[model samples]
Target chain A: MVTISCRDLDVDLGGRRVLSAIDLDFAAGALVGVIGPNGAGKSTLARAMLNLVPTAGGSVAIDGAELVGLAPSHVARRVAYLPQGQEIHWPLSVERLVGLGRLPHLAPFSRIGPVDQAAIESAMAQTGTLPLRERIATELSGGERARVMLARALATEAPALIVDEPLASLDPGHQIEVMALLAARARAGGLVLVILHDLAAAARYCDRLVLLHHGRVVGDGAAGDVLSDAALDAVYGISAWRGEAEGAPLFVPLRRRD
Target chain B: MSLLLPLLLMFALLSGLLSIAVGPAHIGLPAMVAAIEGKGDPIVRAILLDLRLPRAILGLVVGAMLGAGGAALQGYLRNPLAEPAILGISSTAALGAVIAIYFKLADTYSWLVPLFAVIGAVLALIPLLALSARGESALTLILAGVALSTLAGAGISLALNLAPNPFAAMEITSWLLGSLEDRSFKDVLIAAPCVAIGLALLLGQGRALDALSLGEDGARSLGTDLRRTRLQMLAGIAIGVGGAVAVSGAIGFVGLIVPHLVRPLTDRSPSAVLLPSAVAGALLLTTADIAVRLVPTAMPLKLGVLTALVGVPFFVRHLLRERRLW
Candidate 1:
């Protein structure tokens, strides 16, 4: 079982504390959505957990080992990350682009062998991007690019995947499909931590929700408990529709609260 | 993919042979063979061993360093317009060599010039490394490179303006034209080691550069030590390109144009682009050197001038036509 935990983590950027007293734990076989309003430091929190940002206090641990000072390759072997709003700089084919995910596993100067090829192919298949293998990645449409990026992350086959804002700029249909892919990944025993903006989608699909406001964790737990009417009204300054639809718990944000 | 390198290598080899064959000497193939056996005519022996061979080898080595250096710089900065000459790196090395000449240090010690050139290259690379680390835009990096190039040019111009004597000034001015004329085996010995180290360093970075196409953060996330990669690339470009400039003045635009000409053949993968660029660089330079020989002029065209003539136009076209590619 995989376990990622942050205990009272604090992060300072440019002499300003971006996150403070943030404590979070992620376990295997769960999709956890991190939700927050603007400037809530959600991205900062994710970066901290990945050891991308320096911690001012406390520690992050993956499987009981401190993440700070850990080799990036060691972290990559266990946790795959898909950063937000990525831009490809080359016109590499989709096949080669996703194949780069196997770098941490291969030795220097070595070619990708059959095992790596299999993993790359499977990742493309899983994300429905196999057909785009020959296409230049920089020329793809937005939805296709998102899927290709997801495929690249999946090719790592790491136990835990942390993605920031994967749904941004995607249309509704593509959004649901991507969400389903993440949900399936979690169900298949991967720990998936995603930063999401759609509260209803987070409520409907995630096993838990984390709410951050101004670098503080204001709410955490089941979506129903964390995204309550009072919680939404107090934190977001808005009233949201909360009910059940087709036996799945549903939530839709409405007008602002006074 | 496999055949591409061999093809370029063959082309470079032919260029080298052409460089050796087409000089102002009348050494036949039989005499060339006898010369290798040390029994040919003394004039033919001097022509082969002293004049043409070193020039051909220098052309090959300098060309490869430039080509590979350009491709590597482009990969590191993620900008197609990035090259040692256009970015002023070679000028810095040339400036270092000029300082050695201006101070007359080369008369005291022959090795001091390339050493100073390497030092000059590494010193100038500091601002570039810091700027790239800040993850600036392509345009910003290019602008900064242009500024550095301009500053280096001004420094060179100032040195030319204040020579100790007319002869000293002539020596300095001619060297800046970037020719491989009248070079000897000693010059080859001086340039080879630095180029070898730099080339090895450059070629080893293919995998890291491939990963870096994802950007610094993405490459870092994939377990690449961004700091180490940058340091290695910096050392490679400085030592190799700097050494090239030290021995043969400033041959501009070989690095700039070679990689662009080669990128389409390699699917634009930065890693795959480097070696072919090196080979193509050698081919282009050796060919240009040959052209320098054939051009009908009072004084034959300088290698630097021809490459700049071709490169500046191509660079402008690249800016206009392919802004979206990078």
Candidate 2:
């Protein structure tokens, strides 16, 4: 089991505070969704957890080990990160792209061996991208590309998975597939944290929701407990209906009263 | 057959042997080999050992350096079009050599030529690197490289025009054209160490180059330190091209062509491209140098001219395809 704890974490970007003093804990076997409006530091928080961005103040620890003390490859082994706007300038096959995830695990100067191949195959199978492995990743449709990228992350076999806006380009069917994959991973005792713009999707699939506004966490708890009308209005300046369908939490944004 | 490596090696050996033997005089292979082994007639021994052997070896080294240098540049910039010439490193080094030669600085102190050339190559790299980093895009880096090439070309042309005498002017022009002609053991001795150091640096950074292809920000997010990689690339380029241009007078196209030729052999991975490019480069230049000697012409053509002559067609073909894989 893994636990990620961020204590009073602050990040400064372009002379502006992008993430204020924030504290949160993500335990293994939980799906935590970060929901916020644009520029609410969702991506920043994910990046900070990966140590992609420099931390301005406070600390982050993964399973009681300080994130700062870990090397990148070591961090990569424990915590896999999928950035929102990943792009490859060159055309590479999906398999090759996914195989890159095994980099942190392999020894320097070592070629990809049978163990890596097995992991890649398992990852492709898990994400249902096995048939598309030979195709060029850039040539795939948007939803297919998203799955391939997730497969790449899964190839790492990391305990803690952090995804930034993973649902952005996914279609409805693929969206559920991805969310189901994350939920499956969480049920299998992995920590799944995702930043999502779709409140309804977040409410439906996520076990807990963390709301952010202006670089600070506004609310954190079970989805139903946190997605209150007042909190939604204060954070997003809009009221959202909270309900349930088929035993899944559901949210619907309401227009201001005429 | 994917046996290009063995084929290239065979051709390089054949060229090296043929070059030492079939000079202006008809010294046969047996005689040349005997001479090089220090057991032939005095005249043949002098000709082979004192002259032809160094020239052939220098060609081999310069070619290897250019090939390896080109591969590294392409890998670092993630631009297939990047070459020693395209990036202006060769021109800058050529200019440094010319200045040293024309001012009689090399005559006074033999080490000055390569020293100045290396410095000039490093100097040229600074602006290119700086310009590329401003916008943090690979396209901007290529543009900056082109701009440096233009400026460095103008500097070389102006230097040639301002030469003190006809002999200096001729030497300068020939150096600009780039050749392995009349190079002695001394020149070979001066170039070998630098080229070796450069190749070592490039080959060592092979995996790092693979990481870099994902872009600097991506690599950093994956835990690579960008500043360190950039410095290592700079040091590699300076040593490789600096040594090559010092000996061969700015041979072009080898750096550009060798990578493309070897990329397929290495399954298109940037890390796999490094050493294979070096080997392919050595073979190509050695064959071209031999071709120059064997073509039955009054004057042996410059090695640079031979490479450009061969490279232009392939370059055009790549351009027509519009793949930018080269």
Candidate 3:
């Protein structure tokens, strides 16, 4: 099983403290949602964990080895990251865009082999983007572009996947489909951490939740426990109506606390 | 894309042969073939081997350098408008060559002009790249390039103003206007190594450029060493463009125009566009050089002037079409 742990991590960007004294552990076989209000350092935390951003203090480790010491390609083989924005500069075809994920696995001059091709095909299939394989990526709909980006990340086939705001431009159907896909990946023995803004989706889909406020973790536990009215009101500054729907937790934010 | 490479190569080869054959001292195919095989008249052999061959070769090399360099810069910067001359690399190189001319260093040593030009190109690149390394946008880079180009243009004017004699000033003026006229094999020898090295460096970066298409964050997560990629790209442009300017002065627009024309044909892959753009660049410049020979002006037309005449309109059209980019 794969595990990622951060100990008292601190990050400062442009002389501003973005994340401070944060500690967390992520394990395979679970879908964890990182939900927080704007500027709560959710993206910073993810970037810091991946070593994409410099940490001011403390350490992040993957399987007991410090992440900072690992080669970037080695780190890439273990963790896949999907950034928030869906920016595709060139109008590359979907297949070509998705094929870029195999870069870390192949040599610079090497052509895609059988295993790489299979992984790319499988990732596209999982994201339901195989039908759009021949279409231009930049010309796709917002939701389709998001799916293509997700497929690019999934094509990495890394043990752990960290996705930031994957549902931002996706429709309701795509949102549910993507959520289910993440849950299934976790169930299949991969660690999946998703940053989400939709409280209801987080409550229904994630096995666990990590709630942030002022760059600190205010809540971390099972979804139902972390989505308590008090925790929600304090961290998110909103009072939420919480209940169960078909044995699944449901959360609805009704009013601002102030 | 598969067919485009061969077609471009064939076009470059045909254009190069046509350029050699179309010069003032025209030699037919039979004589040209005999000249190559060392059985032609001494005058015919000298005209083909000593005069036209180097000019044609320089045209091809210089064009290839500008085109490939422009494509690589565009790919690296993620902006379609990026080109060597616009980025101030070529002007800085010209400034170096002009300074050499002013000091009579070029008169004494044929190689010093290109060497100093390469140095100047590399120096200009340092500031431009430093701005980009700070994560500046494309607009900032273009603005910086414009500033550098303006400053270099002034420096060239100053050199002209301070020229020791009228003849010296005229020589510097015409050189600044840019030309491939009267160049010899010595000029080709000077530029070939630098161009070869620069092309190698840039072409090796295809995979990295592809990764960079996803933006810096995406590229980093995909295991692309962006710092290294940026360094290689800057160095490649400096050496390649500096060498070309060292020999042929500042031939503009080939870099900017050829890549845009060939990009769609290459499936829009930045890596895929490099070789074909190089070929297209060679073809365009050689054809332009032939146009220079045929234009029948009182004095020979400047290669750089012809390119600017063609390129400036294309650039204006691009800006008007992509007005939203600004």
Off by over 4 Å in 2: A237-241, A253-258, B1-15, B18-22, B85-88, B109-111, B122-158, B165-167, B295-300, B319-326
Q: Which stretches of candidate 3 lie over 4 Å from their true place?
A: B128-147, B164-166, B312-326
Clashing pairs in 3: none
Best by lDDT: 3
- TM-score for chain A as predicted in candidate 3: 0.98
By summed lDDT, the worst window of 10 consecutive residues in model 1 chain B runs over B132-141
**Top-scoring candidate (DockQ):** 1
Identify the superior model by DockQ, candidate 1 or candidate 2. 1
TM-score of chain A, all candidates: 0.97, 0.96, 0.98
lDDT of 2 by residue, A184-251 (tens): 89989999999999988888989889999999999999888788877877777787777778988778
Q: For residues B304-325, could you state the per-residue lDDT of candidate 1 as single tens digits? A: 8988887788778865665566
Predicted chain A of candidate 1: TM-score: 0.97
Go through the candidates in order and give each one's DockQ: 0.73, 0.36, 0.57
TM-score of every model? 0.94, 0.89, 0.95
What fraction of the true interface contacts does model 1 reproduce?
0.76
